[model samples]
Target: MWPTVSPQSRSSPSADGAAILRLEQLTRTFAVGDQFVRALDGVDLQVAAGEYISLMGPSGSGKSTLLNILGLLDRPTSGEYWLAGEQTSTMSDDRLADTRQREIGFVFQFFHLIHRMTAVENVELPMMLAGVPPAERRARAREVLQRMGLEARINHRSSQLSGGERQRVAIARAVVMQPKILLADEPTGNLDSVSGGEVIRIVEALHEEGLTLIVVTHDQALGSRAHRRLLMRDGRIVQDVSG
Candidate 1:
């Protein structure tokens, strides 16, 4: 069963009512053997605070490229990306790193916990990197782990935990910093049906608690769960629908 998160325990949506992220004529191109290939072409998107969205497309359709740019992991070839009303394209590398660390969290298809680290340690890693005090980091790590229903496994190494447990730890780690935007890429691709269902429920719960959730997935069922769905093809968004 999924754990229930109290509203008080979650971060509230942006109070001033601004779009959390916006992309204006975004484009990304990579040189493959002296030939430029456009991965994203003139993409425009606006994500409001607390919106739940899904990006779906076939292979090489630019889904990953778009996500990377949104997460501040990649830069657009020639376009503007605004985050929290700030133009990110002009920010220095340090500013981008700080913004990415503070505003966005990510979960990938493969659980990326260090095998030698305990669940709590994995969760504490981010806070530690940000120079958080040791006591606060430990407390916050345990708190989020407990929320993920992994209290008992908090001290266990990643290698000692089951797939579901490890994924839960990863989720705990991702949100431990309380990022406003959570980007998930094939979050359930590595899990069985039961584990995947549980993971889905957990992320949905976070979305309900006011995190801006954006998911990139191939599963139609998973993609359909978003309130807004985007379909991409040939380096451009072909369809966008909201219900």
Candidate 2:
């Protein structure tokens, strides 16, 4: 069962009116040359707080486009997006950026850590950008890294870590801000099975800790960990299954 998180108090809105994120007739289109491609069309979706969902699709499916819109990284072409009870369809760029920074955490197919920075420092990027005080930032970063089993690797730069280690660092950084939702785009796509499983465990642990997680992946095994799965094809969601 999902929590009754009103739009004001939760990160991801729930479906069945328990939503933390809501989309009605969501659409996204791109103009390429003289042709228009509909990446997403008439999509209606809702994600409640703390639900772990996987968005799955084939190569040309609209999974990435949907994730972008849900993460506030892109806007819909002709629909309404209600995030945390607030209408975001018409927010200014700056306002959307600020809200996104505050409410969404993102992980990608490749670990995007700064090679020059140590693990702890990398995880502190969000806090740093949010103007959190230096002392608090350091402490919070340390706490989250340590929780992610990176206490010993905290001082290691990305160049010095293994793929699994790097992914862990990225996860730490993504969750450090306690965003309402974590958007992972093919997060385990670049890792080996062992490393990939490790990364998935880290993400699942976060989801268990009450974070709403949406993973966009082509890997069915990886996507199965989520509580729900949304399957996409040809710019539409064809199926939604629950575990």
Candidate 3:
């Protein structure tokens, strides 16, 4: 049985006063050759606005699968998912895409910056895709990149930046849209200790600024820093703890 978590565990005062996300009997399965693999098994969860959570487990523990679903990158095989009081399971593809772009900010483990684009341009891509005016996109991109400490690197290509700088660029790109929820998957996995520490600090700072943060990682130190921690095993969330 999964451990109990009180609704008050959310703790943070949210502007919306409703859970940012709610999952009911969430599950994801894949057919691997002749075998059917269950990536997530009957998982249920609730995430309030401004909460910081860490999901930790060994490989194949469903952490990444959960993140993918939360980020709207993948649909659950069968279950209900609610985002900001809207039921997502029944949303059309275009609607889903629109909701994702407007509500979710994803920071991938590997910096997925376009190699040929400059840092500011990379950060502007989301706004462009969302049909924001070109002028507004450029202005917002510059503002977010500057906030991320990338003002001087704004014109640098991804290949020209250091690992830490690249990661910051990716983060800037993720938040450029001002999404309410930030889903980070192994955010510090590819960086050296110092760089990873800096990245984590920035992420935590965002949490302090009231972005609902959920992180999937194998690093114990980073995971432990979250106000709530979940441990998964074999497609199930075996433990959920909150302070």
Clashing pairs counted in every model:
0, 11, 0
Across 1-243, the per-residue lDDT of candidate 3 in tens digits comes to 011223443357433356889999999999999999999999988887888899999999999999999988899999999998999999999999999998888999998999999999999999899899999888888888887888999999999999999999999888888788889999999999999998999888887777789999999999999988999998888998887
Residue-wise C-alpha lDDT for candidate 1, range 1-243, written one tens digit per residue: 222343643444432346889999999999999899999999998887888899999999999999999999999999899998999988999999999888888998898999999999999999998999999899999999999999999999999999988888999988988888889989998999899999999999889887889999999999999988999999999999887
What's the TM-score of every candidate structure?
0.93, 0.92, 0.93
Candidate 3 off by > 4 Å: 1-17
Off by over 4 Å in 2: 1-14
Q: Which has the higher lDDT value, candidate number 1 or candidate number 3? A: 1
lDDT of 2 by residue, 140-205 (tens): 999888888889998999999999889889988888887878899999899999999989988887
Worst 10 residues of 2 by lDDT: 1-10
Q: What is the lDDT of candidate 1?
A: 0.89
In order of lDDT, best first, we have 1, 3, 2
Give the clashing residue pairs of candidate 3, or none: none
Candidates in order have lDDT scores of 0.89, 0.86, 0.88
